[model samples]
Target: MKFAAVLNRDGGTLRNADLAALCDRMCQTLETAGHSLSIDVVAGKDLVDALDGATSRRSVDIVLAGGGDGTISAAAARLMGTKKALAILPAGTMNLFARGLGIPQSLEAALKSFTDGEIIAVDMATANGRPFVHQFSIGMHAKMVQLRQKMEFGSRLGKIRASVKAAWATINNPPAMNVTLSIGKAEIAARITGIGITNNLFGEGHLPYADNPAGGVLGVYVTVAQQRTELLKFFFNMARGKWRDNQHVEIHQADRTVLKIHSGSSKFRAVMDGELVRLDRETTVEIQPGALNVLVPASIAKAEAA
Candidate 1:
């Protein structure tokens, strides 16, 4: 396979080695197995254009984009409906999308796996017209991203530190949005603090997110907790797969959903694969089932190892 990669130089844990040196090592490792690989390093802001340029090279069969969920989402924007496949190198804070795809956390392991990967059609969700591979969410999750942007931390533990601080800062003065979620004939009217519509059902465990990205259904997760204590409890239980048993949070599976601000029409911030999006009074979410062709472990069993 002929492959090209764009690395997010400022992505999580990217300072471990010099950028060019690392790309050379990756090329050597893949080339040793008789596969061709080329990599380019880009700042997070430039990744979109870089992926566009790399994908334009018609000879490249796969494009590897390394970063967090935000970077992967950006790549998916260009790769969707294209003939080429996307290969992820997990180099982000949560690496949620990569983990959901069962890609290993180690960059080297991910590269090796891709060299032997199979092309699988995965689900991609769109809110309005924007594409997200993992999920699109509003309320608390979106606020956390906004807070993290303004805060700084040590490069070594920056991701962890920023997360803790962001959470602490957002828990109080929680987002107050009264929305009506319409799924088929069912309509839910609630004042929610968080709403997450996933591309597929997430696996249960500490992280509690989808491990299989190709599942053709959308999982809708909502938080109805109004009190600070209730909000904390809701997330805690969710991390343990105990949210289904919690009254404050509701999890459902659907093919499509429509969400609108029931009380007042206002523009708000939404989190799409870890990126913030400003949405109008109403946003529609639908699954573009099998909208993306991407690299995944050829062996079914190994692909769910996240």
Candidate 2:
């Protein structure tokens, strides 16, 4: 098969001596798997267009994205609904989407799995027409993404620090957002601190299916924690995947939702996949299932079959 490997060298740390070496190893691994490969290292936002060119010109069968969640989200946007399949390299912190796919974080291990993997149809959701593979979130999680992105130590602490810092900041200044949500025939309103719409259901302790991305529904989680004590309880429940146990948090499954947020005295940040986006008083999220084809470890597929 012909493959286009789109790697983002600057997606993680801006300075690195191993960039060239990592690319070389990736190339060698794919070529050894009997694939005709074309490689490019995306440095900035413009590289998305460049990657589009490489894949289209080569008539690539698969595109391997080597970056963090944002880079993967960018490449996935281009690859979604196409005949091509996407494989993640997970060079960035968190790599939430990659972890969901059961892709190994180590470059060599991931590349090997790529060659051994099989393509699976997975759902992708859109927020205001923007594609997100894993999740679209509003509220405290969004603020965390924003705060960590602005921090000078992003590359230094990697994903773990970014998560920790975001958690800390969110706790310090929790969002008290008044949200009006319409899901299907139900019109509901509440004052919430955060909202998450997931293509595949995943929470702090829950395990999303590794082999099936096309679950055909979106998981919507609303956080209603408004006070510090309530927030602590919310965290405790999240650790056990029993967040729904808390009356402060609500979970629903929906095909689509229209949301309006009254930010009031505080700012609102929205995170799509892992990218931070700010929302005004109103925004809409629609679930578009089977929007992307992904590659997953073959073993996962067999497990599902059994």
Candidate 3:
């Protein structure tokens, strides 16, 4: 097997000499599994272009992405609809998407997935034609990301601190977006403070994790809290996985949905699979059934089968 491994050298946990060492270790691991590899150390924002170039070579069968969900989603945007399969190396703070796939966050355990793994075609949600692996959201969640990205926090804990600050900022100016949402033929008009559309259902209230990756449905979570205090309370409950019980929140599922913002502005800011995006006009959030081929560890496969 031939692989093109792209590491987010600057933004992830591993940095400088440490990142280089991890890359070397990753290459060694792949080679030991009787596979050849070419590694690229790129900045987080440049990952999509780098991976796009790597895949254009058509010399590699799989692209191994190492970083947070943002970096992974960037690669997914480029790799979507392609014949190549994605192999994730969970080099992030939370590794929610990796965890959802049953990929262990530890480097050694994640590396072992490629050694003896099976490619599973999974659903990938799209927000206005942009492919996302995890989710795309608008309002408060997007506001948090918008603020979190601006903060210069070098460490993971610093990121948490930054998120807290972002939450406060969001509370100061609560988001109230009036929109008409269409799920199938059902039209609903509401003022939504935040809405999350994940590639799969989140079950009851699993926080940021996907309940079923191959369920072929999009989980739609909408928050109706309109006040500053209500926004904070809603987010607090969400963090504790109690948001579903809150009367201000609504959770549902669909294979496709359309969201149209009411009058006000032409374009709105959104969070796309952990990345910030500015969306103009009505956006179609839909599931592309079995659109992405992802490789998972043999252990995960066996466990799922069991």
Candidate 4:
């Protein structure tokens, strides 16, 4: 297969990486495996353009995007419903989407995985017609991301620390809004602190990312905690992957959902795959089963199939 690799120069761990050496290694690795590869290292501001250019090429079969979750999400959005597949290089803080895809977390290991990777179709979700590989969240998660982005963080560890601090701040002063959730014929109205709609149901373990990206449903979680203590407990349970046991959270699954936010503010913000964006008063969220083609470690793919 022919691959076009786009490395985000300003994303997470890649900010301090040797791009030239990495590109050389990628080319050599892929070529040795009977595949051809071309690489582009671009600034964050130019990432979208680079991705667009790479996807537009007729010679490219797979686009190997190297960066954090946001970069991978952007690449996935560009490749939706297309014949090209996406290969992820996890060079970020959490690398949640990479985790869901079962890609190696380390750069070197991820590169080697591509030598024997298999292409598989996975589910992708969308918010207001915009594609996302991960979750679309509002309230607490969005507020935390907004707060963390304001603080200076150089390295991956620094970013994690900043995120922890932001999470604590959000927990202390959580935002609440009137939300109407519509799933199928059922409609539920509630005052919630936060809400998240994931691409698939999050598996129980260490992180909140989905273990089965091929699950053709959206997982909706709404937090109704009002007091600081309740909010703190909810977050604690979520961190321990015991959110299902938390009474403050309501979990539901659906093929599609409509969210209407009744916040008084004219402008609202939400987090879509870790990037903050303006939110519409009413947003339609839905899962597209097997809409995205991704490259995963061959062994993992075989094991899952078995």
Candidate 5:
């Protein structure tokens, strides 16, 4: 298969990487595996154009996107519902989507995995009409992301530190909004401190990402914790992977949900796949099952088949 590799020069670990050498290694590895490859190392600002140019090529069968979750999510949005498949090179701080896809977190190991990769269809979600591979979250998560964006972060470790501090800030002054969730014929109303709709149900005792990306349903989680103590307990339970046991939390599954937020402020924010964006008052979130084609490690493919 022919591959077009787009690496974000300013994203996460790539900012300090030897990009030229890394690109050479990737090209050599793919070529030696009897596949053709073309690489583009561009600044973060130019990532979308590079991706567009690559995917527009008639000869390109797969787009290998290297960077953070946001970069991979952008690549997924372009490739979704298309014949082209996305192969991830996890160069991000969290690399949550890559972990969910069973892709190696290390750059070198991820490249090796791709040499024997197999293409598979996975689920993708959307907020209004915008596509996302991970989760769409509002309230505390959005507030935390918004806060982190303001702090100076030059490196991957710096970003992690910023996230921790931001999370603490969010816990102290957690955003509360009246939300109505419509799932099928059922409607639930609450004043939530945080709410998230994930591409698939998150596996327990692990990072907050789907273990089965093709699960064909959305995971809905709402936090009703009002006080600081309750919010702190909620965070602690989440970190321990026992959030479901928390009485202040509610978890559900649905193919689609209509979320209506009743807030006086017209400009609310939400976090989609780790990037902060303006939230619509009423957002339609749904899962498109098997809408994304991904090139994952052979082991993952085999295990899924079994």
Candidate 6:
């Protein structure tokens, strides 16, 4: 297999030495497995366009995205519906999408595993026609991602500082918005702080991507709390997987959903797979099942078989 590894050099914990060695090892492993590999680095601007041009020329069998979820999602946008299989390296703060595919955290292990993995179909949800792998959120979580982006954390201690700062900001100012949620034939009204719609349940205590990504439906979680104490309670409820049981929060599973911001407030923010975007008075989200083909461990197939 001829593969093009699209790498983000500045994304995660990788240093010069680790990255050099990873590339060396991956090249050797794929070569031994009777495959040819080409590595491409995506710089700051026009990242997707550059990779798309490279892959198109080489007719790459697999386009391996070696970066954060944002990079992977961007690359997946171009690779979807093509015969080429998408690969993820997960070199990010939270490798939720990569973990969902059962990829390993260790760089060498993930490369080796991908060389022997199989292609599988996964669902991709869309918000305003934008693709998202994990989940989309409205209020507090979107604010957190924005805050976390500004902190510029490279070390564990720096990450701690950023987290603390974001927590404080979230506590100090909770968002209040009137959201009109429409799913199937029902329409519900609520004053919400945030809304999270996931492709699958990651179970309690696990990251949202702990479940398989190609599950064929969307899991909608809406958070409705306007006070600090209520936010803490919401946290505990989500931790215990009792958010569904909470009166303030509403949970639903559906093939598609549309959320409209009916709040009289001026500005609002929403996150689609860790990337934040400003929303107008109205926004629509829908789940597009089996839109992307990805490479995953054979174990996933076995589990589905069982």
**C-alpha lDDT score of every prediction, in listed order:** 0.81, 0.75, 0.80, 0.92, 0.92, 0.75
State, as a TM-score between 0 and 1, how close model 6 is to the true structure: 0.91
How would you encode candidate 5's per-residue C-alpha lDDT over 183-247 as one tens digit per residue?
Answer: 88999988889998999998888778889999999999999998889988988888767767789
How well does candidate 5 match the true structure in TM-score terms?
0.98
Tens digits of lDDT, candidate 2, 66-147: 7777788888888877888888887775676777777787777888887778887777888888888888888888777787
| Off by more than 4 A, model 6 | 15-17, 236-247, 264-266
- The C-alpha RMSD in Å for every predicted model, in order, reads 2.3, 2.6, 2.0, 1.0, 1.0, 2.3
Misplaced by over 4 Å in model 2 are 13-17, 154-159, 203-212, 236-242, 264-266, 304-306
Instruction: Give me candidate 2's TM-score against the actual structure.
Output: 0.89
lDDT for 168 (candidate 3): 92
lDDT of 1 by residue, 170-285 (tens): 77767878999998899999889889898898777658667667778889998878787887777677768675667987888888899997655455688888877776688888
Q: After superposition, how far is residue 190 of candidate 3 from its true place, in Å?
A: 0.7
Worst 10 residues of 5 by lDDT: 261-270
Query: Candidate 3: misplaced stretches above 4 Å?
Result: 204-206
For every model shown, what is its TM-score relative to the native structure? 0.93, 0.89, 0.92, 0.98, 0.98, 0.91
User: Model 6: how far is 134 from its true place, Å?
Assistant: 1.2
The sequence of per-residue lDDT tens digits that candidate 6 reaches over residues 54-77 is: 558556888888876678888887
lDDT of 2 at 151: 65
At residue 255, what lDDT does model 4 achieve?
94
